[model samples]
Target: MQTISAPRADARTPVETPAPLLHSIVLDWYRENARDLPWRTPEASPWAVMVSEFMLQQTPVKRVLPAYAAWLERWPTPARLAADAPGEAVRMWGRLGYPRRALRLHAAATAIVERHGGRVPDDHAELLALPGVGEYTAAAVASFAFKQRHAVLDTNVRRVFARAVTGVEYPANATTAAERRVATGLLPAADEVAAEWAVAVMELGALVCTARSPECGGCPLRAQCAWQRAGCPPHQGPARRGQSYEGTDRQVRGKLLAVLRAQHGPVPRGQLDVVWPDDIQRDRALDGLVADGLVEPLADGYFQLPQ
Candidate 1:
């Protein structure tokens, strides 16, 4: 998929303020108000953190809580999940949406078992080499789970960096070298503190510097925030919009997957056909699913979640 190139940072991006002061404020705020997410708990394993990262992509914490709990309870380790059929992962994914993530995660588990002695590797390069892990996931697992001093740039952290330092209402559509420099420059000197700072900034963005309806009045960074100082200027880039799902191909795909997920084995074509009225759209969605390896076509005229 093509992505819009990120604009280079210019004079508008503010010079970062004192790092220690910035760290202290956000870290304190996080200590007081961070959500009691299961992934953040001391007892959470590396595999547990990796699972949470996968489930939390483009998905809210509220929706992920139950699924995360159920998933860990069922397959507590990479070896355990690696032993199961990939189809089982899709079934266990439930209605959290984005079923393809399930397949990638299952594949990652299998790789971990095969190459890392059933352990989720702490090394960023090894993490990135995993099936579903990308730059953000790699940085996230390294920082959050291993207490490494890497810049963990996710949506929330990017938003925080944009508004607080870049004097913008939003980050660019794509992650940029400028954004990485800003994130890296602000990292705390110590590895452990940098890890804590990464999560703290993310928590602040999630709870206070939110996408819509940000509670700036209560934000600890209000005094120094570039966007706030600039009167919270509106987004100057292309019109920002949320993804539409109703009546989209994604919706049709979800419905078809629902039928497959419910059954124990391959479903008849006739049974899958009833999920949508438009045969063209439904067939296209099913074909896309099969092409994506989220579904498998059997010798018989039937489909099922990939084995």
Candidate 2:
């Protein structure tokens, strides 16, 4: 029996080579098959892209679509959002979950206004300096909005790369520099257009090469996929921790925020109590909301969205 060794860190592997086949195949497929997400449209503004990215951090597209449109409609630009109270952003966030993202987005808008002259900065480092922007988001904004050459390595992209390059069903816990190198190696030569290719690859990962129940038959890269050649083995790594929504503080927090969102101003403790039966749990949830800067206490014993 013969055994195959994994590619070494220093080896001049085929995966490291600028495989035109991979880029052309993925980009060509993307041109015809990409989802008509509003943010991906050519007319999307930087502010719109930034908002979409932030809203999409944990929320799915189906949930984010209406909220994204409503958010931009209310606060069209960084200056507009920055001018409004943080409370308004919280209210606008609705039941999107992770309400602190709303506060951070508000802070980011203010920072963009004060530091970047009311425009989303094109520089990756400058964008990363914003409140909620991380490596993936910074690269996403730079590539999607600014049309720069950056490897946008999100979970989907990481999975795609792991399967395509290393024939793995899943990637490691966190992205490493090696992953970046592999992604960069696959990037197209033209910096201006490379961003599109990056987005196309990410779209493919999200829509086709999903974590569970991947539609391998319909995948565009089926012919060239390393995982397909390797017999499409099941992922055997440590299982990812599934999120618990029921009986958790997050659920209570969402319930509290939902009541506040429906109301105009301060909501009484009695009104909030109806959402959760447990008094201690409700109090803890409200306290967590306050700690997270998503809620504030009013003159009476009422709670309001943070100002």
Candidate 3:
């Protein structure tokens, strides 16, 4: 067991070798312990990886698996998705929650077609330029799709690193340059294949090193974890806010969209009214759906999936 000191917040010391060593430990553990997710399969296309990334955001894996398979089957390429109607994309998104991601993914596909000749961009900068592709997403595509050496830091990866490397109970609210520098230090020197390692680590965090009730006993990085070494310190900050689904606008919006998605064209306001009781909240939710471009209003005051 080896220990490394946490760098000062303002310190810019070159990232040390412990990160790569820890990465190797986790990657090797991933090789043996990794789940056989569809996106992780060798045959997964770059487009498939991109779609999976978007679907997995804020959504659970079990919920995403079927949708991911169905989405790829429907649109095997960015060009295929770009050619489809935006409404169709929303319809396919179903009840995955945060339907905005589906629209953003659709927009990203359109951008791919217009800007990158219908190919998912391999370059990090170009991928970042896409509608929904952010730092984590760009790095994910670069590594998973192109096998680039970039560090793909997401919530899972951030927590894993924070615990294993820095002995922190919680990761910062957002990733910083210091985090990126630390992540870059952990990346394998082999520039072409390090992305797999990044995804592997993230998977480990999601499935094993979870925020609540981490299965540290089964975690591969347990032996190297700083937090584990420190007796798994309790999270001391204010408890995270709980999201209310019952009677909330999001629930109302989901119900409204469900009706439109299930039907062919504009559903009557009468039918929409059946989904929720409160007119004010229902109207607000409906207006939000329309604003999000997930629904469109018909001439007759009915609502339809956005065209």
Candidate 4:
């Protein structure tokens, strides 16, 4: 294996990434070891890829699989989903957590139908213009769905770059301009190959370079990893911690939504009040849900998901 140089201070001129070797090793590993995800299939339409990206945000693959299947089964096309009430989208979202993504996806589908004739647009700029389509989601859709050249910097890809090239155990708490430059620099020159490279790196991070308990011995990048070369040093930056779900407002919100989801039509305020113990906390959670458009208030103090 060829020894790649270390990354320099100026990320704009990053020359440490041996693009050819990295692509070769990672892509080969991906071909053999990549998860058989529905979205990665050649038959997966751009709409399917768009849906996966939305659901996968902060949600795990195992949890997303069944929901994804059911979602596509019911609404395979953007037009199909767009035609349904936004409340149905939220209901279909189930216990996926972060129900706001459901509403955003519905809005995006509506925009797709209106703007692009019900087809998910291949143009990166056009994708970015859609509702709930941010930089990461737009790039992911363009590359994965359309095989276009773009740096798809999700958390997984960022962690891979941090350890493999930048000699760090983790990336910054938030994405930096420097990180974007590093990602762009590592991209292959060819559009289709670059798309493959992006997913390969992402897969590498997801499988072998995980945030905790990485299986470094099995990692394709193990030999070339800068963090490994540096003796697998500990994270020197701010302390990393996982978010607590129990007893939090998010739990209360989920519980409140569950009741609304189970019922057919509008639910009375008193029914919602029984889910949580504290009156103040339950009221706050319900109010937050209403403000977020996840719940619609009806006449006579009844509530339901958005119509």
Using lDDT, give the best candidate's number. Answer: 4
Off by over 4 Å in 1: 1-16
Q: In terms of lDDT, which candidate is stronger, 2 or 4? A: 4
Worst 10 contiguous positions by lDDT, candidate 1: 1-10
Angstrom error at residue 230, model 2: 1.2
Residues 185-272, candidate 2: write the lDDT tens digits.
7777788668988898888889999988889999987766777766887888678888768999889989889999888888988899
Deviation (Å) of 147 in candidate 4:
0.2
TM-score of model 1 (CA atoms): 0.94
True-structure RMSD, every candidate = 4.9, 3.9, 3.7, 3.3
Q: Please, what are the lDDT tens digits per residue for candidate 1 over residues 1-307?
A: 1111123356575345577888888898888998999999999999999999999998999999999999999999999999999999999999998989999999999999999999999999999999989999999999999999999999999999899888899999889999998899889889999999999999998999999889999999998888887788898967767789998899999999999999998898999999899989998999999999889999778888888
Scored by lDDT, model 2 comes in at 0.87
**Candidate 4: tens digits of C-alpha lDDT, residues 26-64:** 999999999999999999999999999999999999999
Best-performing candidate as measured by TM-score: 4
TM-scores of the candidates in the order shown: 0.94, 0.92, 0.91, 0.94
| Model 3 RMSD, rounded to 1 decimal | 3.7
Residue 285 local lDDT, model 3: 94
lDDT of each: 0.91, 0.87, 0.85, 0.91
Off by over 4 Å in 4: 1-4, 7-17
Ranking by TM-score: 4, 1, 2, 3
